[model samples]
Target: MKDRYTDFKEDPRFKIANREALIGCGVAVINFIWWFGFAYGLGSKPVDTYTYIFGLPAWFFYSCIVGTVVIIGVVILMVKKGFKDIPLNHEGGDDL
Candidate 1:
């Protein structure tokens, strides 16, 4: 092992951080796609031709209500299963 240094080239924490960042970006992109697809797909129709679910527009119900529930569940599941709560301390160093 190399001597004590604040910065290291092969730190495993870097990998974890990069992976989590990518996951966050991917989740954001997926959320945007879901909102856009439903909003445009259903909202594009004539107002009088639109259908209502629970007194909300089809697009609003599907994109906002259902999407929020689904996305929250997905994010919770991902954080619980895919993420690691790594300690933010250096190797052989004092706690930070």
Candidate 2:
């Protein structure tokens, strides 16, 4: 009997993948907090007076429109700065 499972800790690509995964998770968490906080936190305010932003509620504008733009920019920046391109054939690996 032999240990069949490979240890990912010894693989060079493991660190890169781990870093990218962490960045992706962080982005997801930030987006979740931003949207939820705006939708529930701000939308729950008193409606005594009508407040409109571009014919929509301020909460909707900030949560959906503005948040989307900001998230897009953040994703682009993360990909450019945090990711590296490794050639698939460098180690005789099949190109998928």
lDDT of 1 by residue, 1-96 (tens): 457784557887888999988898888898898888998999899999999999999998999888898799879977998788887877746965
- Per-residue CA lDDT of candidate 2, range 1-96, in tens? 236575433667767888899999999999999999887776888875537799988888888988899899999999999888865464747776
Best by lDDT: 1
Clashes of each: 0, 0
Which stretches of candidate 1 lie above 4 Å from their native place? 1-8
In model 1, the Cα lDDT at residue 12 comes to 75
